[model samples]
Each structure stands twice: as structure tokens, then as C-alpha cells.
Target: MFNPSPKQFKFIKALLFVLALLPAVRLLVFGFTDRLGANPIEFITRSSGDWTLYFLCITLVVTPLRRFTNWNWLIKLRRMIGLFAFFYGSLHFTTFLWFDHFFDIAEMLKDVVKRPFITVGFIAFVMLLPLALTSTNGMIRRLGGKRWQWLHRSVYAVAMLGILHFWWMRAGKHNFEKPILFGTIVAALLLIRVYFAWRNRGDGAAKSRTAVQKRQVTPTLT
Candidate 1:
């Protein structure tokens, strides 16, 4: 039901790339026009942070979508979407580092220590670095498939930490609708992954048992 030619896929990918940038581009336009609300820093920071979570959710959905729909092509887009998650995450962290701390490494460290929200966010951002660095084909080949998969599994932890960070940050304001919504989505995606893994294991075990039973019966017949 979902088959696209090479040219069509290329076109679609290009379209997604441009659409992904639209948020940042929109922020730039707002900044240029002095329209980022009264507190521009807060506006930009929140916008970047929101997009980071959004992209993370989108990245996590790729597997479930591909598996359930049988559209393998969705896997091709996961890397790009994951990189965008990192991109926005970097922007979110940079906003705090440059604007909030003014290049003061000491102060940044202090904030990470003194502030729980910053702490979780920093941890999450740090975890994204390795994933982004090793996202290339060459690195994957060097790391081998199993090791690479293990390392990239950090995305799940990063997703949880990110939600916690966002949740804590919003706690003071008593606004939790967004965090709760995204947290539910991430949780559902993770649970779906676990269910599929369990199902595969069960299927494999059943197949092995059946093969063994057939071997025993064949010896008796002979």
C-alpha cells in the first residue's frame, strides 16, 4: 500500500528536510522581525526544546511504523529524523549555554549541578552526542551491527531523560499537559517495542521445538 519509486522517495525526503527546518527558520524570521514575544530568549529556548522532543518522538515511531505497516522504506528516514532530534537538542542546549551562561563553563557546570532540570537535560543531550557521532555508515560498519545497535539504544534513555527534564522545567509553572502527552507517546512506543521483541522470541522458541520434535519422529519412522 505504501510503495514509492526512488525518485519519489528522494522528492519526499527533500520535502521532509525542508519542512523540518521550517521551525528553526520560522524562529529566525521571528528574531529578525523582533517578534519572539517579550522574552526572546525564553521563546527561542522553548521553541527549540519543543522541537527536540517532537523529533525524538518521531524517531522512536519509525520502528513501530515500519514493522506494523511492512513498509521498510520508513527505516531510511529514521536516521535523518534522529539527526534532527539531535540538531534541535543541540540548539536547545546551546541556547542555555550561550545565552543563559554566557560561555562560562563553570557557571554551566554549576547550573547542571544546582538545577535538576538542567541536570537531566544535560545528561540527555550528552547521550545524543554518541548516537549522532556514530550514525554514519562507516562508523556502523566499524562498530559492527550488534554493538552499534546496543549503543544507539541509548535513545530510549535519552527520551526518558528528556521528558523528565521538560517535566521538571514545567513543574514550577503547573503546566503539565504537554509533558504528559509526550511522555505517554514515548511510553507507548517503548512498550510496543518490548511486545514485539517478546513475540519474536516466542516464535523462535516454538519453531525450534517443532524442529526438534520432527527430528525425533523421523528417527522413529526410519
Candidate 2:
């Protein structure tokens, strides 16, 4: 009932694409202007990692928001936002791999082994690749709707890994503020998802029992 026309939806999507890139663009501008603070590499790494989590949190809440508001149009933007999460995540990993390790495979592997935060961060990025690859309609068709949905549910795992990564990274610096806040948001989103899933399952079970009860009574009436 509140659907936008094709043209309007296209425009909305175009606007969202630009909005999604604004963070990266801002980071780039800051880098060019030398506004990324004393340690530019650390600044860039933190900023990119922050944005990836921000996008992941935003993407996770989309469904809960849609459910509460009944605004189906919100879903149209979910894919775009999820991809941006992966985009920022890629940048974050590249910053670590290229700038931090200078493409040293052995060094990167050793760092992953030595650093708990980096290990989880690496795992999260690896999880994102499959989701990004399977995001297209073609891939969805190939995987079938149910399978696609199941695979994409891995986003929850990615988000949890992201939170763990952030928490451990911040713990080293004694900075738990942002980590706790984002963790709360992610927890809320996940709880909302579980609540709905359980509610729907209960509703389905209730319907089945009602149908069976009616069938049992029908023969007596005959």
C-alpha cells in the first residue's frame, strides 16, 4: 500500500548508494588533507573498522524496523547497506594487510595468530565474501529462496564476530565505551529476530493444533 513506483524506487536507491559511500569519501578527504590525526594508519584503520560495524548494525536493524513500521520499502535499501558493510570491511582488512603488513603473507599469518582481535576480524571478513557474492538475484535464484536466506543468515555470525573483534581491540586500549554501546545495539537486533522467529513458530503450531481439533470434531458431527 505504501510502495513507491519504479522510478521513485530507483531514485531512492541511487540516493542510498551515494549516502553509503559518503563515509569512505569523507575518510579519503581526511587522508588527503592530513586530518586523520597523529597516527594516520591507525586512524584510517579505526575509521574503516568503525564504519563497517556501523553499517553492519544498521543492516541488522533494517528487518526489525521494517517489521515494526510495516514499511516494506525499507528492504529495498537493506542489500545496498549490507554491501556497504562488506565494502568498509574490505577496506579495513586491506588497510591492515597492505599498509600494516606490506603484503607479507607470513607476517600477516603470524599477526593473525598472535592477535586475537585480528583473528576474529579476519574470520568476519572471510564470512562476508560469500554473502556479498551471493547477493545478486542470479545467485539467489541459483541457491533457491530458502537456501539463500539460510546462507545470508550468516550475517548474524559476522556481526557477532565483528563485535568480538571490536571488543578485544578496544579492551587493549581500555576503551570499552563504543564497544559496549554497539554490542547492545547488535544484541537488541538479534533478540528482536529471535523473538519474531519464536512467535511465528508458535503461531504455526497453534494453527496446526486447531486444524487437527477441527478434523477430530468433524467426524462426530457427520
Best by TM-score: 1
After superposing candidate 2 on the true structure, give the runs of residues whose Cα lies further than 4 Å from its correct spot.
205-222
Give the worst 10-residue stretch by lDDT in candidate 1.
213-222
List the global CA lDDT of all models. Answer: 0.88, 0.86
TM-score against truth, every candidate: 0.91, 0.89
Give candidate 2's root-mean-square deviation (CA, Å): 8.0
| Candidate 2 residue-wise lDDT at 99 | 96
Q: After the best TM-score superposition of candidate 1, give how far the Cα of residue 23 lies from its true spot, in angstroms.
A: 0.5
Give the count of colliding residue pairs in each prediction: 0, 0
Model 2, residue 222: what's the lDDT? 8
Regions of candidate 1 where Cα sits further than 4 Å from its true position: 205-222
Q: Write the per-residue lDDT of candidate 1 for residues 76-186, one digit (tens) a residue.
A: 788899999999999999999999999999989999999899999999999999999988887777876667777888899999999999999999999999999999999
Question: What would the per-residue lDDT of candidate 2 be over residues 5-98, giving only the tens digit for each residue?
Answer: 8888888889989988998999889989989999988988988999999999999988788779877677778888999999999999999999
